[model samples]
Target: MYLLLVFRAMRNFIVVGHKATTTPSFSLEDIPGTSGRLDILCRAVTAAFVISHGIRKDVCVYLVLLGGEIPKTIRLVGETLRHLNPDERTTAALLKKALAVPATPEWAMSTSGIFVRTGGLAEVLTDLKDAKLIYLREDGADIRGLDAPGKDSSLSGEAAFILGDHTGMTPEEEALIEQAGARVVSLGATSLHADHCIVLINWFLDTNVFMSG
Candidate 1:
């Protein structure tokens, strides 16, 4: 009976994306509480990978950037895989893909009162850092921290504001725009005329594609 239970668990692990080459070997003695050592072995192996895979890539990048041997990163990734939740392990894979492409370009938009003017240099690029869309470099310029393929200048004015500021919108404002399927842009320096601001805000808030599943 114990052997049969162990076999069943092993089959389940194989079905759930375990690669045969890297699977760990387990002996009955390795597991203390189990009546069936084989079953415990299977559980240990599956649990280890499911929890660690998501964090593996990030940890690898960190270690490599620090000038350490690359092999160490691989071992660390393997180690981290032992502790992450299974869902997080799966999501990490998806996050890696999502981060592969640049989300949008960064450009400056002008705001007057409630009105936003797309195009032209941003009156205040510094404010974008506060919104988390861009990070301030040592030189005091805001830059996209993610390794996006194209030149930073390729970003459009509207895209910059949208990426920079939408996350900070008020719940009411966000809800209304979300309900209307509108795109939101960063609210920067206020315009002189409220009507123009309204038009710009409305336009900016209505243009993004939702990608999260």
Candidate 2:
């Protein structure tokens, strides 16, 4: 019930990483090279909530790390989020702090608004079971023309957006996303970085893409 309420009032971005470490051992200085492309996830996190003068309290970013045997998830809530910077490295630093803390079976707070827990793609899907799922892809229905992609009366905007890292989702990971009923939508004919895709998605919703209709 709480999650449903949150989803109805906010937008969610979930970035799945196949190689991001589940531990705090990742080096912040070299995120992409040492942290298994965690820099990509960091950039996506920054793009999700950093507005011109303030952060969107209604936004959230879920980092699903699948490098270890047990998956780790970081939930960055914008409502209570503080000390966030617009750059990727600063966000990476925040992630590093979250990873340094101990995440129990349940969600543990690493900072003001960051929560870390033990779960991955399956866990995220369950958490957002009641929300509309948007799967960002290179070849699917164009995002601007679809209602399944959100911005309808149900939630007023899109719910959860699922994305892949630099290497993209594995065949099995894709299967899990398909089973979750995520609507695959494309931004354009050419593929863009995950961070860039996020900014575009936000723009469509913020500017009311329904103007075309």
Candidate 3:
């Protein structure tokens, strides 16, 4: 969530489901606990709450667990974040509670936010597009040394960036990105983890450190 807070303009995150199994589009409403992938799901939930303020404002996270016993997509809306202690333990407990919520589109209240939908990256981007938000893919050409030439200027205003997990985006995921026409931008030539990329993006945006040769 620190990433979300740092880049305040970035309000959405979508985890594509490549290996996960279920229907093509499934809501995370009522699947049995044993049906969904809880490990990574829990981690995503923790990350969502960690960055959210006690009083909701921005930030929304989506998880698409398609390879599990049942395909489920989860959403944690930042607006509903309340009474959540910003600690590892509390986040874990909240995750447990979310996992048990009945599979329904209705928002499931957690100590932090509400989990209420299973949406693919394409679907989510469509929503953002309808809202007129700029979308960028956080990969492809490096933007490290191009700050002075207007590359950084392209990032101005409210926008959303697409980032993959540790394993990176699969070929199928890339295809969907192409369909969305998201401009590809990079931080550096060296491959950095997704988390590091977020920090660097924020640092560069908030200060001129990245512009120095």
Candidate 4:
């Protein structure tokens, strides 16, 4: 049953890097410095998909970049994910390359499992496809006391955890999230890196699912 749940469940991590570059002009060596703290999103990608021995094939990661004139969303689906190692630099390269692709309001495949779209947080919220949208906030309800995730019919057995970058979401962004009716959840009092939070959420679901199954 544990193995069954592990193979069948789907988990999504969406990180909004408000200052991250939307264009592909940032230097590879300065992802954090020049890319406007894109290093944070890169680390979150590692946490979402990387695991011992292999990738988490059941996971998908969303990166929203809002620095350039237009906001862009880069998606990485782990089931068919390839060419992604567990390093931040290479991941940064992939993200940069994805942004370099031709702009499309619709999703355009930059690589095998990665996709780039010309939109931001609001568009993503409407594309949930019955997935429950959860906002990770320090003041929300504690995440420790939740039921098994991705099992509700109303949600079509899907859920996505949305996080903000180092600078956190702007007030306007926060208002948009709340307006979308996001279920806010807390990780604790102390602040944590977005990547670390992703790890914690993944572990919470994986462990709880294994135990429950």
TM-score of every candidate relative to the true structure: 0.14, 0.88, 0.62, 0.90
Task: Supply every candidate's count of residue pairs whose N, Cα or C atoms clash at under 3 angstroms.
Answer: 15, 0, 12, 0
158 in model 1: Cα distance from truth in Å? Answer: 4.7
lDDT of 3 at 143: 54
Better of 1 and 3 by TM-score: 3
**Tens digit per residue, CA lDDT, model 3, 115-168:** 645445666676667332322344466654445544644444444556665456
* RMSD to true structure for each model, in Å: 24.0, 5.1, 7.7, 3.1
lDDT agreement with native, every candidate:
0.23, 0.83, 0.51, 0.84
Model 4 accuracy (lDDT, Cα):
0.84
lDDT of 4 at 173: 86
lDDT at residue 77 of model 4 (Cα atoms)? 97
Best by lDDT: 4
Q: Candidate 2, residues 111-196: lDDT per residue as tens digits?
A: 99999999899889989977778888999778756643334532254488899988877888788888998888889889799999
* lDDT of model 4, residue 28: 90
Candidate 3 to truth, TM: 0.62
Model 1: per-residue Cα lDDT over 1-213, one tens digit each? 355331101000001111111111222343222211222223322333332334212111000001111111011133223333444233232222222322223321111101111111122232222221221112322222222335343222222122111122235433433443322322343322222332332232223112000
Tens-place lDDT per residue, model 4, 99-212, is 889988989998889999999999988887467778998888888656644433122246788999888788998898888878888999889999999999887777664422
